[model samples]
Target chain A: MTEKKTLKRFASVFLASSLIVGALAGCSSSEEGTTTTTSGGSSSGSSDSSEVIKIGANLELSGAVASYGSSIGKGAELAVEEINAAGGIDGKQIELVKVDNKSENSEATNAAIKLATQDKVTAMIAPATSGNVIATAQIANQYKIPTVTASGTAPNVTENEDGSINDYVFRTCFIDPFQGIVAANFATELGAKNVAIYADNSSDYAKGLAASFKQQIEANGGKVVAEEAYVAKDVDFKSTLTNLKSKNPEFIFIPGYYEEVGLIVKQARELGIDVPLMGADGWDSPTLVELAGKDALNNTFITNHYSSQDPEETIQGFVKAFEGKFNESPNAFHALGYDTVYFIADAIKRAGSTDGEAIQKALAETTDLSLITGTFSVDEKHNPVKSATVLEYVDGNQKFNSKVNP
Target chain B: MEWLQQLVNGISLGSIYALIALGYTMVYGIIKLINFAHGDVFMLGAFIGFYAIARWDIGFIPALIISMLLCAIIGVIIERVAYKRLRNATRIAALITAIGVSLLIEYTVIFFRGASPEAYPEVMANKSISIFGASISSQSIMILAVTIVLMILLQFIVHKTKIGKAMRAVSHDADAARLMGINVDNTISATFAIGSALAGAAGVIFGIYYTRIDPLMGVLPGLKAFVAAVLGGIGSIPGAMVGGLVLGVVETIVSAIGYSLWRDAAAFVILILILILKPSGIFGKNAREKV
Candidate 1:
């Protein structure tokens, strides 16, 4: 009887210790996870507004669109550095609270929530991609946080489906319709009568760009000979390219990201369809040239936000600074990132406060803002009324062709 | 003419499926476990080839050989570490372990190499040869030739060699074969090594053909190859080859007819229909469940 009582006492003690260990482990692991999530940003838990103003950067640091996210992050970093060096927005240094969305839409929303609630950020800079920005913008709106995107150019990003403006959502880049019209005008100028479009059906950005480009092409009196669609992450385009070859269109328009576009170009060329390929800002990555051989890029063109070859003084200065810092040429996404930071800072300066409502009003009233891309102002729908640059790749070099104004 | 062109495209794609299917079939024939991680092994093969070409600057043939050899070792290690322990466990246990290994390898690769798709460098001069108004690239021809050669070699090893006979004996009955002095464990390891080597070759060919490699690249191809293995009769060698070709052609023709969205769905639909119609598969033999 004494031995049994001792055994029961031992069992209870063991259970209590196990529970304590489990709780300790859970606490440490949760802490570790939060630390990793908040590691991308500089300041953490600075809710007391006096020391520094916390601005959240929700970007895609890893996944399919990681290249865009990384570049945009670097550009934002450069802008933050320059701003802080120049006595940061009314004597309060801006502290960027960055979070990687892992190139996922759902994660973007989560990142936004964490930034708004957990980090207590004053304003948030959203992701570059339209799909991700659209996903997170709703959360930002619900939280009444002024959210600005660097390059989410889809029309519905700043506007609702019923054509209502999103009060908290704003962008530093032009919309898809403007980019599509620019591409169509460029193609028409090249004397193309009929064109084929190979679009990514799964992506909102691709479908949006393709639809607008088609509308603009027909409006310009040019016929769309063949239209083909493929989902993202599809590596094989031989069958579709083969079918397109028989149609023998004058040119091909691929409005998708660089990863798919590069493979499509290579496959199209291999199939002996030698028509020039055109795309939108999605083809601004260096991987495009690497994937599609340098020789294959001779006749390719893209409607970009900024060309690294631009000789404008403001653009040149940004380019030189970006190259010196990142040791790589800045693409359109980089310019947009730089512009997004400066735009947000300008709004804060005008508002004279870091309050969400104040920033939103100041952002809506933004005018005559000179950015790396172009001098522009935020329109009624919170999209920039800026010009798009047409970049032509000749012999592997991306040369600035011309600018198209909205 | 369009049909003919799609047919060529199908053959090219089918050959890759076939190469991958051989590994699945052979591994399943020896062990009842569905080696779900076989696809990731193929993915590793592609990465090995990528490093071979980009980092080592080696020729295509040498890279192919190196990848195959390295994958064979990897397969053996995976079998020894993960499968060997579960050999006597329930079928469900082994199957679940396979899935776990698959996830482990995929995420491990993602952790080491970022999830972005890397461009596979052009290792060979690309030249297309037109036949009857349909174009076939030299890369396609090379893939087909290599698959055929590997299949022939596999057949020889399984049918004629001592190890092959021992493998067949072990597959018939592991305990009985061990009683008869055959090293069942060694035979199982050999089967895994051979199967993994074939997967490695398929990876290199796929990378060369697609010119894109990512951590998740093996998922779809692996599932399709599993379907191919099922369509051809899971335990049959010749069945896998024929099934892969048919699947490739059907997918190509479906896409050619402007139903590209249904391309992935078609493979699963075929799987369901085959399961409903011929559960034993085209080449699968109907056998009673042992007590």
Candidate 2:
């Protein structure tokens, strides 16, 4: 009986200790929750009354798209550095609160709300995947947080059936339809008649590209001979390629990010299916050639926002600053991220305050603001009205194919 | 016609799953460990094959052999380092350690490979051909042929070899086998080495067939292969192959008939249904408690 009592006492003590530790850990976690600032200025304000400007970033910091997110973050950081250096936004340096959502939709939505309610961010910028933005837009709308997505091109992000954009949601990049049309037209102009479409069916980005390409192909009296789809994690495509072989396409149009597309191109080339592959802005990565190898990527064409080959002074200046800061040429996604910050900075300045409504209005009214992508003028749907450049992979290097001013 | 074509594709995919399941089942049969790192080893094989081809300019057959050898060696090392220490601990400890090992290997690969999907070298993947009323490529043929050959080889090794008898003895009664002067430790390591080698072969085929290799490539396929192992009766050799093939075919058919959006989630749903209906799996025998 005495031994039992002692054992019970020991059990209770252990349980109590665990409970205490757990409680302390939980409390510490809450205390250490992400630091969020308000006031469209940097946290390094010289005085308390200077009004803090909080710009929240919901990005994928880890996962397959992590490279894109990190690059975008670097670009955003660069822009903030420049803005702060140029006497700040109305004498207030912009403070960026970046939350890594890891590309999950629900996580991004929750992070958006956290930034909105807990952090009280004045505005938000998302260089997120399409699926994430689709989920986060509703939250942004609910909280009335004006958001600028750097590269989410899915039509669902900002559209209603009535042809109106969600008032609070805006994008700094061209929509998918715009990119798709440009790719299709470019393909047609190149005299490619029988084209194959390989897309990531789960992604709205890929789906939108496929649909637009098919429509444009049919319109131009060209045939979409084969359409194959894959998901994000799938590493095998033999069966899909085998099926595609029946169609005998002249060109392969793959509209997905570098991770899968590089492999697909390499695999297709290995399978003795040698045809020029075409893709969207998703192909604008140094890793593409590295992953797919120069031979496989040879003769491939893609539409992009900016080219590292751009000799224009404005573009060269941004590239120089980007390289000078980050020590690498900024890809198109990085440029969008950089341009997003500049766009937001311009909006904050035009609004004359960190008020959310004023910032949204200023963003909507943005016109003729020259960006690295091109001169930015927000369309009625809040997407950038800009031209796209065509790029070709030759000798394992991205060369400017042609410029399309649409 | 397209729907019919998709069904066939699903079955073919199922066959690949089955091949992977065999390795999972074989390892679990001997040690009752999940071998969570098996898929990554398979991925390593693919990368090894790639390196062999690109760096050494080895032909497909030679590269494949080299990949399997590397994978087998890694497997033996994993067993010696990770599994050997946990023999006296609780089963859960071993399971957790296995998970830790899996994560360690996966992250290590990711750190080195970066996050991008790499293109498989062209010599193996590019041949487009039509076979049996359906268009198939050279990659599909090679993958299918490799899986079949592995299955036959495994059957031969398991049913008709002295090592196979030793393996069976160890699985049935480890204490008795040790008492009978069997080299139990070496036998178990060999078992792991063989199973992991098979997984490596699967990985190379998958890489060539898919045409891309990425750091995160193994996670989903690994999970699905585990499910296939469980579905086919975890300890049964033939069962893993059958289970994998069935699961692959079911996923394909479901996506072809319904929407492709639910393709990934469908595998779990089927697994749940199967677990509910047949707790011991389709071919699993009641395991006698060792204690």
Question: Could you say which candidate leads in DockQ?
Answer: 1
Q: Return the top candidate by TM-score.
A: 1
List model 2 lDDT by residue over B171-203, tens digit each: 887889999989988989989889888877877
Question: For residues A274-347, could you state the per-residue lDDT of candidate 1 as single tens digits?
Answer: 88889998888778888888877888899988888888898899889989988988888888888899999999
Measured with C-alpha atoms, the lDDT of residue A398 in candidate 1 is: 92
* Number of colliding residue pairs in model 1: 1
Question: True contacts preserved, each candidate?
Answer: 0.35, 0.14
User: Tens digits of per-residue lDDT for model 1 on B16-109?
Assistant: 9999998899899888889998999899888888887887799899999998997888788778767887888999999997897788777666
lDDT of 2 at B248: 82
TM-score of each: 0.87, 0.71
Instruction: Single out the weakest 10-residue window by summed lDDT for candidate 1 chain A.
Output: A27-36
For A1-406, candidate 2 gives per-residue lDDT tens digits of: 9999768855653453333223212322232222222223344655453555778988877664776676777788889889888888888877888887876888888889888988888889864677788778887778777898888877767886687678888887888877788888888887899888889876777888889889988898989887778887655454466466557888888999887787778666755577778999877777678667788788899988889788788899999999998898888888989999999999989999887888889999999999888886887878778988899899898898888877
Off by over 4 Å in 2: A1-64, A80-123, A130-146, A160-164, A348-356, B1-37, B44-165, B168-186, B201-211, B214-216, B219-291
Root-mean-square deviation of each candidate, in angstroms? Answer: 7.1, 8.4
